[model samples]
Target chain A: MTTAPLGQLPGQTRRGERILIGLAVGLTLLFIAAPLVFIFVRAFAQGWQVYAANILHPATLHAIWLTTITAIIVVPLNVGFGIAAAWAVAKHRFPGRGILVTLIEIPFSISPIIAGICYLLLYGRQGLLGPWLQANDIQVVFALPGIVLVTMFVTAPFVAREVLPLMQAQGSEQEQAAVTLGANGWQIFTRVTLPNIKWALLYGAVLCTARAVGEFGGVSVVSGNIRGQTNTLPLHVELLFNDLNAVGAFAAASTLTLIAVVALVIKAILEGRRQS
Target chain B: MTAAATHTGAPIRAKRVLPGFTLSLGTTLLYMTFIVLIPVITLILKGAEIGPERFWRIISSPRAVAAFQITLTAALIATAFNAIYGLLMAWVLVRYEFRGKRILDALMDVPFALPTAVAGLSLTALFSANGWFGPVLDAMGIQVVYTIWGIALAMAFTSVPFVVRTVQPVLEDMDPALEQAALTLGARPWAIFTRVVFPAILPAWLAGCTTAFARSLGEFGAIVFIAGNLPFRTEIAALLAYIRLEEFDYNGAAAIALVLLAFALVLLVVSNVLQAWASRHREASR
Candidate 1:
């Protein structure tokens, strides 16, 4: 049964439906766009020179540098793991597959703050691995490694979530065909499976990258928020805001917002293409 | 395969199988166990260490109890609001054609793109006493920033996309002819919606709301900035968990975390059941 029951209105009431649709569209746009507009207004209202200065500050530069480095490390790690997990879960019918799928999604449900605490419990000074790590002078918490780990934890499911369903829907026919044609596993994966999943992988990576750059709660607990050292862009934005430098905060935030907007535009374009 | 035979020069290597399924599944299980399960299990174990009486006392303290109530209430309010707004937004985007529609669609993802802290700060600035909306509301003797209302607003901003994204696909997939058939049969718009379109999309809508509610319950960064963080009045459970951690109260933190976890589990179970039932109903109707 085709379910396109269009709204029916008498000729006298047709105008009312248009008004209702207009109001719904208008309200949603206003709610979604207001904050973004507010940021730009605040940023520019204080003169362009102040905005430029704030954006070009050494600390701001450092925060962006740190965030970029973290993303570089995070995106690749997640992509590799996402591929592996997606490959296993989508193709293999192993015992505990259901449980594993649920476990993979636990990070999505658990708060990022709690994820930070988990890392602390596992590798903090008093944690289970703390003694061993301490003996080797390995600092996981309040360090780059800790930041990367938490980011990985939070973004683990992205690529897997993207690729799994695609793989499931497409099935193992291509791989089987390749196998019969004398292609080895690695060759099939690199040449066959990889090509099919490349777009989904890219989409997932874009999302993971955006999330990693904006990650705060988990990183906040582990980074110790040490300004000019461990503080990421998001943390830096908060730091500047707390220090009462609202202009600087807005400037830095606007830049991050710009990056995010660009990423989102790309995601939307890709998704639109995928839909078409 | 010939490629495998050629790649492995050694005859013995060609004859050997790599145990792909076994190796990959083993690695995946080991990774999940080490990364996700162990940490959650540790939290449960730590909570158990505090003993039942102590755990109950910690979680039942006036501050903790108040925080839970406020968090739940605000989350429910936020989720309910988003359910209506998100559904409308999704419906418009999927069904309508208008000027600036593309930009409007892109704006829906702004919440996802922007940092929670930044979103929180913007809202605080916009709604504080001397700020934009703050002055307007102040004239009416109504406060938003640092109140439960602020918390709910922050949550609604972040969660608007969840329901929209979830329901949009289902709505797009729905066949238009069904609605046309209902219209031809003299069903009113409202009747058609409730009887036909609603049932098809209700499952996705509920799933989206569940996700949005869970997200709002756990939300801290955005709410923290605008919530004023008043202990008994505006403090949320997740924020309380943070406070306990700050105070070096590990047991208390674990207790609060356990409570949040329990609620999340319950919601997940309910959502799963609803999804299953809805799918079965759809199949039977078909």
Candidate 2:
């Protein structure tokens, strides 16, 4: 069936179908590709010096530092969470397994804006734990910790979502086999399960990193847009744009755009290798 | 099997074979509770604190209603466009062989990878009156930036990938025999698609569109840049919620946030139902 010539044979394109595909691809090129190109074009519109100056601007550099720090903190934690969650759900038969999976997915369905607001309401100076937090002299909302917290919230499901299905499909047979041979659980997992899932784990990690760095709504609400303090790359782009510094905004945006392109390139290569 | 017994003649203790279940599950649940559940629970509690009357008053206010209307309408428009464009893109991807097809497939994920803020900025630049496409559009008197159309465009850009990716796999997996059978019966290409191929992929397509719509509803970063955010004219519900929070009106923010949350939850339920239906149909078809 896979080799059959009956299903959508190449070179049999009908005129109407050709037109349809053309129209669709054309729309994508216009809407999707055009904007992407426009970012780079506009970023360099004033020449490389201006672009470099905008990029090396103190606030932009600070935003980059913050974004990188947030991703550095958030990705590994989520990777750990993903491994644990995937192991529990995929390797064990438990009551409420479905509920556990659904619970993990809660953040996915919730709006990032709401996720931000939820954190603010819980930790803001006027929030439920506001007085307690203030007395302790700890800041969450409008600070670095709040930015990390919300980024974690928004990017929570990526690693697990990517790795879970693969683990479930692979099953626990190998682990059981290793156990029968007197292999310790950790030994079996490290020697066997981890190797099998390493690719998926990396894929998930890449996705998590991209999302953590690019996240805006959740981080925006919590970061308070404090220049050179809590502002992330995304927030900096907005601040520049709001200040009507179009060149600076797009230049900062280009850095983010660069990260995204690199991510896409890596993801594409991984996907290609996976297919092979 | 014999390895389980021969090494230990002193009787094998039935230590659980798959260890770490308790520890892994414990950590997973604990982390989820602290990070995700607690904050969400706080939002719900806050929303409930405002009595039903006040909740209704906030949600029913003209500004809130307009936000909802604008969000829903834009999402609907985006979904409608994606339904056609996405299906075609999927068809092109699955059926035809072309140079750079692999690159094209990868390109679909750019919106997912690109920061929404970046997408918003670039799109606004491209469509604003002074931008490249902006001047052409201006000639046509079609203002996209700071308009509802811009909001819809942003939504469409960000969400179309859902439709394409979802439908692509299903379409690729479909058996050739189904289409062949239809063709053998003298069905035209369109007829075969409508009668055989379409039905096979319809459930998944619908599921994809629902998810796309759901995603569009929650979109904030991309839309906020393009949307003029005039309260009764262009502001989206997500932005409204954020605005309410900025003003320190916790009740107002919670109220609007709750509405968006409820909408998302409802869409999720609907999409899950469609997904289940799709799976059941696939099973029956097989």
Candidate 3:
């Protein structure tokens, strides 16, 4: 099932297959690489001094900082929530388990922009919780808290999707054995379940972090694009672009492209290892 | 260890790391209700606030109707393109080994990682009248950017991975013996694929296509930058929704959103059914 089938063909057929495969692969690479290459070429063509100046600009620096802060807060919180949800869904078999599984995947179907609207409907001034929150002077929209909340909502499913399948496949045998041998619930989970799921959890975390960092639509709606304050890296790129600072826009975009490339590399490596 | 066994009155004490299934299930339901269901319900509720006549007016207005038509047409074209290309890419990756195979495989995920906004901008730059390929197309009098083709291009870029990712796994898990036996009986590669391989993977391919369509339908960040936001020409439904939001017409925004939500829900159900049917087929074949 895993072996390459083209190797079994006749020499001419094999050569033809190779050429076809080469063409397909070549086009795919060109399509994927063109934008990243264009950004780099455009960014550096003007010289390093211009690029450095843009990088050091306060607004640009703040955008990067705000994005990092959001990631720091959102990633761990989602990881915790994801683990809890996955633990419940994977190990349990009560009524509504199917519905819970379906519910966990709702974020996938819902647009990030809609996710922003959802938050607005819940926490906006005219929202269900708006009065209470406003009375307490808690600003959720056009604020950092709002930005993080929507981001969290958008990325909530990643870790759970990763952890759920692995947990279900592994089942409760090991955990049961540990419990029967005198380990308590917490100890069994810590000593057995956690260790087993560590790699998958890390993989999921990497994906979630990448998404949280790159997230723009949901965050944009709530962040208000307040320069140097609520702006994320993606928004910063847009801001620079809109400001007609083409050089700065490409520079920031290149930085994000680099992060995305790194994340892709990590994901590919992890997936490859799992396959082998 | 038998502490529960010694207790005659109590049902077998359930020893578990997490709470009982009922409690956990309840928690999951409550959380999803508060977070997902409520917001979605509110979106529809807001739309309903506009009386039926007004709701119909909002959705059927010239600009809004054009946006819907353009969005649907571009999504259909892009998804069709992806259905063919993605299948080829998946087949090549799963069935062949060549130099740079690993690199090619990794590149499939570029759209997913790259922010949609950046993708839209870069594609516009690449295909616009002044872009690298734009001048070449201009010689032949072809326009892309700020046109329907540009919208399709943006949609295609973001949607390519959906079909590829969905089909690749099914292709990988497919037993090679079936193909080998067919070939041994003197069947040609095309016949074997069309007769045997295609049928097996058809359900998954259809599912992937539906997902790609749904994704393209909702895509905004990328399309907005490239679509030129021209009413009745390039404006998409999602952009219309945003326009309504920007205009502070919450009723209109909610109405458009409801249309998108309904479309998405239908696609979701269809894909789920296709996936379920495909898995059942695999089991029966086994």
Q: Chain B vs. true chain B: TM-score for each candidate?
A: 0.88, 0.93, 0.91
Q: State the C-alpha lDDT per candidate.
A: 0.82, 0.88, 0.80
The order by descending lDDT is: 2, 1, 3
DockQ of each: 0.45, 0.64, 0.46
Question: lDDT of candidate 3 vs native?
Answer: 0.80
lDDT of 1 by residue, A142-170 (tens): 88999888888888888789988898898
Q: Which residue pairs in candidate 2 have backbone atoms (N, alpha carbon, C) closer than 3 angstroms, thus clashing? A: none
- How much does each candidate deviate at the interface, measured as C-alpha RMSD after superposition? 4.0, 2.8, 3.4
What value does the lDDT take at residue A194 in candidate 3?
A: 93
Query: What does candidate 1 score in Cα RMSD to the true structure?
Result: 4.3
lDDT of 2 by residue, A1-276 (tens): 234365554345466666866776787788788888998898898999999999998988989998998999999999999999999999887789998888888888888999999999999988999999999999999998999999999999999998999999998778878877778768988998999898889999998999999999999888788888888999999999999999899999988888889888888778777778
Clashes per candidate, residues 3 or more apart or on different chains = 14, 0, 0
Ranking by TM-score: 2, 3, 1
**What is the per-residue lDDT of model 2 for residues B1-286, given as tens digits with 9 covering 90 to 100?**
4354345554343333477888999989999999999999999999889989999999999999999999999999999999998888898889876666776777788889999999999999899888888999989989899999999999999998989988898887887788877766666787888888899899999999999999999999999899989988899999988888879898999999988888888988898889889888778777
B1-286, model 1: which lDDT tens digit per residue?
4456346666544232322566666666676776677877877888888899999999989999999999999999999999999988887778767787788788888888888888888888888875677898999998989899999999999888888988887777777778878777877777977999898989889988998998898887788889988998999998888777777677888889888888777777776676676566556545
Flag regions of model 3 displaced more than 4 Å. Answer: A1-7, A10-12, B5-31
Give the number of the best model, judged by DockQ: 2
Per-chain TM-score, chain A, candidate 1: 0.92
DockQ, candidate 1, vs. native dimer: 0.45
